[model samples]
Target: MASTHILSAYDEELKYLNRRISEMGGLAEQMCGDAVRALVNSDTALAQKIISDDVILDHAEREIQDKAIVTIAKRQPMAADLREIIGTLRIAADLERVGDLGKNTAKRVIAVQGTGVPRKLARGLEHLSELALVQLKDVLDVFASRSAEKAEIIRARDEEIDAMYTSLFRELLTYMMEDPRNITSCTHLLFCAKNIERIGDHATNIAETIYYIKTGAQLEGERPKDDTANTVGAPAE
Candidate 1:
């Protein structure tokens, strides 16, 4: 009877960890979407709200870490059980970073205020953010289902986000070169785009963690990356 009771309590602890992770994932998704909307619309009020709400993710991460540490110490989990706790810690950290990226993007809203973003650039940012958010949401679903196959699929899709970011980076550079007047706003947009790109990276990290938890193996080889922004040179004089 005591053994059964201990097992039940351990299961409950794991459930609580998962529940907290889901809440953090949902909040991070909302913050990322709102941050981009605020940037495109120059909505300082909404951006400020996102910045303030970031503390929630930070708090949740710390809570998860504390709980996981205590559970590990108490249960002395091994094998797959230990992997699950470790995976939760890794995912929580990635989600916290996602929230930080969203907060950073929201901070750009104040910088670009009163300087209108071009419709073309706005659309580009929106599309890029849409892809990143989709990746984040999909990986969170993969985490919940514990499907290694779906996690691998999400891992491969990171390259798509990188490609989109590279395209937008070029477009922003062109806008800056064409008109000196566009430099300020375009520069801020560049930072915002980078933040969105990083959000995708965090999503990929979570996908890898899920894959490890399910399979007990780190993904082999370098992660596929196509961000060519660093390779592009200045336009011919």
Candidate 2:
């Protein structure tokens, strides 16, 4: 009876960990959406909200980290149990970075405010953001369901986001060359685009974490990386 009782409590702890991760994922997704909306619409108010909400994500990450460590020390979980906890930690880290990148993009909106950037260029960013958000949402679903196959699909599609970023990079360069006055605003948009691209990369990272959690084995072969990003100023901005 005592052993059963301990098992039940451990299960409850795992459930709580899952709940925390879900909340964090939801917030990360919203932050990115708001950041992009701010960029395309020039909504500084929404951008401010995204920046403030990033603090909430940071706190949530620390909370999850604390809970994960406590679960490890008290439960001493092994095998799949241990993998789930570690995987939660890894996903939380990526989600926090997602929040940070989104917040940075929001800040860019303020940087380029009143510059009269081209609507076509802004729309390009909006389209790229849409693709990234879909990837993030899908990967979060994979994490929740522990679906390795779905995770693999998400990993394979990361190259699509990189391709979108490279195309935007070239377009932005052309715009800047057409008008020297476009340099400042285009540069800001370049950083913003790079930030969204990075969020896509984090989604891919989460997919890998999910795969490892479900399989207990590292993914084989080199991850299908898009070398086009190397020419995107490499999506590291």
Considering every candidate listed, which one attains the maximal TM-score? 1
Q: What are the candidates' C-alpha RMSDs?
A: 1.7, 3.1
> RMSD in angstroms, candidate 1?
1.7
How badly does each model clash, as a count of residue pairs? 0, 0
lDDT by residue (tens digit), candidate 2, 78-143: 899899899999999999999999999888887788885688987889899999999999998888
User: For this target, which candidate reaches the highest lDDT against the unseen true structure?
Assistant: 1
Q: Which stretches in model 1 have alpha-carbon errors above 4 Å?
A: 234-237
Tens-digit per-residue lDDT, 1-237, candidate 1 = 999999999999999999999999999999999999998899999999999999999999999999999999999999999999999999999999999999999999988888878889899999999999999999998988999999989989999999999999999999999998889988989999999999999998998899999999988878989978777785756
How much is the lDDT of residue 132 in candidate 2? Answer: 95
TM-score of each: 0.97, 0.95
